[model samples]
Target: MNINSIKIATVTAGYVAGVWVLCSIAVVIAPDTLRYISGAMMHLDLSQWDWEMGMDTFVVGLLAWSFFSWVTVWCIVTLYQYSLRSFS
Candidate 1:
């Protein structure tokens, strides 16, 4: 089966953006809980990690992460397509 790389990338990016917004909301609502969860997941102390939830920082991070996710997924799909052709 062939996959539409652009469509998949767009969808993945949108999903990531949605998740980012939700996480931002969570950070605003329960920062300490989020920090603890993150620390536990990474097995590192994030108590000293300062979180700057400025508007500018949030906007920039959202854009940068979405774009990064789009590019990464697009590349992966393209490579998968190439591998399928090579194997066939």
Candidate 2:
């Protein structure tokens, strides 16, 4: 089956944006929990690190991450389509 790269990328980007919004809210509501989770993921101590989120940083991060996710998914889908055509 062929996949629509644009649609799939948009959906993936939307999903990532939603997660980013939730994470931003989580950071405001439960920063310590986020810090702990981040620390665990990184396998390092982040308790003493300063957690700062400015409006500019948040907006930039949201845009950057969403765009990055969209591009990544688009590329993957395009590659998959190419591989399917190549193999069959």
Report how far off residue 12 is in candidate 1 (Å). Answer: 0.2
**lDDT (tens digit, per residue) of candidate 1 on 1-88:** 9999999999999999999999999998999999999899999999999778889988998999899999999999999999999999
Tens-digit per-residue lDDT, 1-88, candidate 2: 9899999999999999999988988998999999999999999999999778778878988999999999999999999999999999
Best by TM-score: 2
User: Each model's TM-score, in the order given?
Assistant: 0.95, 0.96
Give, for candidate 2, the lowest lDDT window spanning 10 residues.
49-58
On lDDT, the candidate that comes out on top is 1
TM-score of 1: 0.95
Candidate 2 ranges with C-alpha deviation above 4 Å = none
lDDT of 2 at 1: 97
